[model samples]
Target: MNKLSCILLTLLAWLQYSLWLGKNGIYDFINIYNTTKLYENINDITQMRFRNNQLLYEIYDLLHGYEAVEERSRYNLGMIKIDETFYQIKL
Candidate 1:
C-alpha cells in the first residue's frame, strides 16, 4: 500500500509540473500574446506616421507649391487666369 501511494504521489506531481511548465504552457502563450500586441501597436504607430507625413506634404504644398494650388483652383474651384479662355464640351 505504501509503495502504491508513493507511486501515485509522484505521478500526480509530474502531471502538475507538465501542466504548469511543459511545452505550449501558459507562460509561452502569454509571451506570444504580448509580442503580438506590441507589434500591433508598432504597426499602428507606423501608419500614423505615414499619414502625418502625407498631411505635412500637403500642408507644405498648399503654403508654397504654386502648381498644386493652381491645379486645385482650376479643378475644384473652376477658376481661370485672366488671359485664359474657359470652354466646356459635353459628349
Candidate 2:
C-alpha cells in the first residue's frame, strides 16, 4: 500500500510538471502573450515616428517655402506686401 501510494504521487507530480511547464505549456502561452504586446508597441512606435516625420516636413516647408510663409502671414498677421493695395471690405 505504501509503495503504491508513493508511485501514484510521483506520477501525479510528473504529470503536473509536464502540463504546466513543459514544451507546450502555460509558459508558452505567457510568452506568446508577451510577444503580441511587443508587436503592438513596435507598431505604435512606428506610427509615432511617421507622424513626427510628417510634422518635420511641414516645418521645413514653412521655413523654406515662400508660399507657406505668405499664407501663414496673411492668415495670422493680416500682412500685405509693399506693392499690393490693402483693401478692407466692411461686412
Candidate 3:
C-alpha cells in the first residue's frame, strides 16, 4: 500500500500548510495584531504632538498676547486693572 501511504502523507502535508499559511491563520493573526498596535502607537504620538502644539500656542499667547494675559489674570488670579471697578453678582 505504498501509494496509499504516499497519498496520506501528501494530505497531511497539505493540511499542515493550510493550518499555518492559510487565511485567518496564526501568521495572519500575528501580523494584523502587530499592525494594529503600531497604528495605535502612531495615533498616540500624533495626539501627543497635537497637544504639545496647543500648549506651545497657549504659551506664546500668554507671553505676547495681552488679551490672553488679561483673561488669565481676571479668571485665575481674580485681578483687575486699577482703573476698572470690580463688580460681583450673587447668583
Candidate 4:
C-alpha cells in the first residue's frame, strides 16, 4: 500500500509540473499574452507620435501665412492670381 501510494503521489506531481510548465502551459500562455500586450502598447504610442508630428507640421505651415494658403488654394480650389493664365495639358 505504501509503494502504491508513493507512485500515485509521484504521478500527481508530474502531472502538476506538466500542467504549469509544459508546452502551451499556463506559464507560457501568460508570458505570450503579456508580450502581445506590450507590443500593442508600443504600436499605440508610435501611432500617436506619428499623428503628433503630422499635426506639428500642419501648425508650422499654418504659422507661415501666404505660402501655405496659396499652395492649398492652388491645389484644392484651383485658384490663380488674376494676372496669371491657367493651363491644363492632357497626357
Candidate 5:
C-alpha cells in the first residue's frame, strides 16, 4: 500500500509541475493573448477619429466659403489661372 501511494504521489507531483511551469504553462500563457492587437486597434481608432475631425473641419470650411474650394483646387487638382505659370522643383 505504501509503495503504491508513493508512486501515485510522484505522478501527481510531475503533472502539477508541468501544469505550473512547463510548455503551455499558466505562468506564461503566450499563445492565447491578444492585448497587443487590441492596443493597435485602439491606436488606429484614435488616428481615424483625428482624420475624421480634420475631414469634418475641411467640409465645414468648404461649405462656408469659396476660398477653401480654390485652395483645394489649386493644390489637389493642380489648377492655375489663365495668366499664371506653374513651376515644379524637385530635390
Candidate 6:
C-alpha cells in the first residue's frame, strides 16, 4: 500500500510538470504573443519611416527645383507664363 501511494504521488507530480512545461505550455503562449506585438510595432515604425522619407524627398524637391516652385505658384497663385493664355471653364 505504501509503494502504491508513493507511485501515485510521483505520477501526479510528473503530470503537473508536463502540463506546465511541455510543448504547448502557458509560458510558450505568452512568449509568442509578446513577439507578435513586437513585430507589429516594428512594422508600424517601418511604415512611418517610409512616409517620412517621401515627405523629405518632397521637401528637398520643393527647395531645390524650379519645377516644384512653378507648380506651387501655379496652383496657389493662379500664375501663368508670359506667353500663356488663361481660360476659365467653370462648372
Measured by TM-score, the strongest candidate is 3
Error of 6 at 85 (Å): 0.3
User: Tens digit of lDDT per residue, candidate 1, span 17-90?
Assistant: 87778787877788889999999988898898899999999999999879989999989999989989889999
Worst 10 residues of 5 by lDDT: 27-36
lDDT of 2 by residue, 1-91 (tens): 9999999999999999988998888888899999999999888988988999999998999988989889988999999898999889999
Q: State, as a TM-score between 0 and 1, how close model 3 is to the true structure.
A: 0.54
Per residue, candidate 5 scores C-alpha lDDT tens digits across 1-91 of 9999999999999999998888888765654456667777778988988999999999999999899999989999998989998889999
Residue 28 lDDT, candidate 1, scale 0-100:
75
Q: Candidate 4 — which pairs collide?
A: none
lDDT to native, each model: 0.90, 0.92, 0.92, 0.92, 0.88, 0.91
Tell me how far the alpha carbon of residue 18 in candidate 2 is from the true structure, in angstroms, after superposition.
9.5
Location of the lowest summed lDDT over 10 successive residues in candidate 1: 19-28
On TM-score, the stronger of 1 and 5 is: 1
Ranking by TM-score: 3, 6, 4, 1, 2, 5
Q: Model 6: per-residue lDDT, tens digit, 13-91?
A: 9888877787788778888999999999888988988999999999999989999999999999999899899999999
Q: Write the per-residue lDDT of candidate 4 for residues 1-91, one digit (tens) a residue.
A: 9999999999999999989999989999999999999999888988988999999998898787788888888999999898899899999
What shift in Å separates residue 48 of candidate 2 from its native position after superposition? 2.0
Per-residue lDDT value at 21 in model 3: 94
Off by over 4 Å in 4: 45-91
Off by over 4 Å in 1: 1-47
TM-score of each: 0.51, 0.46, 0.54, 0.52, 0.42, 0.52
